[model samples]
Target: MNSVQKLGFSENAKLLIIHADDAGLSHSENMATIQSLEEGFVNSYSIMVPCPWFYEMAVYAKNNPKFDYGIHLTLTCEWENYKFGPVSPVSEVPSLVDENGYFYKKREQLRKSATPEDVKKELQAQVEKAIKFGLKPTHLDSHMYSVGSDAKFLKVYKEIGEKFDLPVLINKQLMQMVGLDPDINIKEGEFVIDNTYIGEFKYFEDGKLGDFYKGIIENLTSGINLILIHPAFDDSEMKGVTINHPNFGSQWRQIDFDFFTSEINKAKLKENNIELVTWGDLNKIRKGK
Candidate 1:
């Protein structure tokens, strides 16, 4: 059965998951993500376990156990100045790190060097650390799409998700985007969204974010849809953290925050009859399976 039916929704129901990514990269990111989850249309977020602000996110998750948060299983630290390495010992997962002893700054670098054993070790360590800090993570997803970039990495990612009984973010569309076979068999009972949208900020050149999102919401199909957004305050902190990167930088994130939080966006959801579901809700389906 498809996700909508499996979740007990009508066949034509438009299910949407507005998930904020990079929740623990910096103070600005943490603050914006918390606000977006608590006060805005964003229903879910994932914590970057290897980032500097991970402890802050962990404490928040511990205190607010009801929020739908997950581990953004991190392998590559893509910032210029800001960087992090494996939660496991460097000696143990040596192939997962660069010469500087930090995670490689790009997915291409990681894909060339990281071994499956190292990936599994580091991923397990990240999940274990989150659980140790009192976070019952709702799901798992990759940072920089690293884990899903290769078949071997994906194998370890799937294994870890199965081990934890948490949903790993995977979709046929995304698989195809990375030159993987879209028809790759997923284990029975594993939750997979039918479609996932990661906003392309290049389309937001001339105050077009509202239109871009509205178009996406309107075009959403029957099955579950996950929209990945990075919501952060456009402050000095965020600016500094995302110094050279304009793709998902401070201003870009603020636009996401603004659009997702706007009353018009809420109205659009109601107008389109889109049912916002959380990763926690998806977990219920996993449990039943």
Candidate 2:
């Protein structure tokens, strides 16, 4: 039996947490995530509760409670045209929402004017909304790593996580769960990458996708490794929405999908016998299965 199955999870032997982020951002993302989960390519996913399509994804979760899912705490609406406002009222979270009634476009912008009280209220509202929709999220994480960058935000996030009895992804926890620290720099372009973090989550700038595959292969850890990736097909809709976004839009996300399913990645995982586990199984292990 594989590590996850040994721990009394589903008979599937591998223990992986292949998650698709921004589930409610667009139909393309939602469809891809569902397909990947059905195909056994992705084991878990997270939803952006503030986005337009959040209700659809929430309904899917309610119908399929067996699917390991979580909340991707959305503090900013990075994309234009397809923007989302705060889950709480504008009066309550005015610091997080912009003048146009949408959330801030970037972390730095939010940090400049945001307060801890507003963040706490907004986060609680998100959780309440999810529960109201009959969704019991498996875990919690920031949409754009907003909680991790600021100490005040991190404190609120951790408190909310504990209150909900959910695990919040932390570099300290990740390092402790996994064996070693990665060698590369963890920060890139307003995004913070955690080294205890396995996987190449950074945007590929002038580098081949092979390098990312190699990075994951070379850095496989003994315990649970949670790698985050945004997978989407490069279509006109996604392009139009995300084009000119500094984060490389669908190009980087498509490359992430390719790297995740690449031959080199398969070979490395098979060679190392690394298990792909979901957060559910990982939590079980943490709780001393």
Candidate 3:
């Protein structure tokens, strides 16, 4: 049988994977994630373990263990003022860090400079930190698809996932067409929502964000559908934090908030009989297997 069949997901029912990215970035991100979780617009979220406010989010997770969360394994510090130092000491994984002691500025720089051994060491350090902080993560994924893009990195990441017995996201198309192997050795879950399913979510756009409700009209398939969103307030905090980011993750995140909470989108889903789900379900299914 194929990967999806191995995971035990029903082939007929459409599964929705609404995951919120960037959970431990700032207060804006934290508040947004909580609101989205309560609102039922987002099913899963990942935390940047190396972020400055990581412990705070970890505490929240410990208290409210019901939320489905994963580690957004961070290898690079993309922001300027907002940056995190390496979890592994400089002496241990010197290549993963810069002269100033933080991680490299970009993925390309890290990919070029870091050795496979150094990458593995840093990943272990980050995961250890999360466990130290009392986070029983539901799954594993990269912050910027760092593991998925590089073969060596992917190997280390998958090793960790298998060691921990956690479920990870690996696009089937990438596996076939791009030759991106799974970071872990486990069989693919029964449920599968390929990227093509997510590519169809045009729920929210600029200006007329209200018009996105029309998207729910399309009949959804029975398989899983993962909808990725980055939601945050365009407050002074997010603005100041993401000043140099041209893609404006903070600003674009605010746009996600608009789209997710829009009544049009909610009504459309209700009208189309779409059911939302969380990664917690996937974790349970994988754990049962």
- lDDT (0 to 1) per candidate: 0.86, 0.69, 0.69
- Order of the predicted models by TM-score, top scorer first: 1, 3, 2
Which window of ten consecutive residues has the lowest lDDT sum in model 3? 196-205
Instruction: List runs of model 2 lying over 4 Å from the truth.
Output: 1-16, 172-203, 246-248, 261-268, 286-289
- Per-residue alpha-carbon lDDT of model 1 for 49-111, expressed as tens digits? 988999998899889887889999999887787778888889999998988799998777888
- How does model 3 score by TM-score? 0.82
Most accurate candidate by TM-score: 1
Alpha-carbon RMSD of each model: 1.6, 6.4, 4.1
Q: Which ten residues in a row have the lowest lDDT in candidate 1?
A: 182-191
> Over the stretch 163-274, how does candidate 3's per-residue lDDT look in tens digits?
7777666665434333454344224443334542221123322443334323423556555666666678989888878887736456677877777766666666666666
Lowest-sum lDDT 10-residue window in model 2: 185-194
Best by lDDT: 1
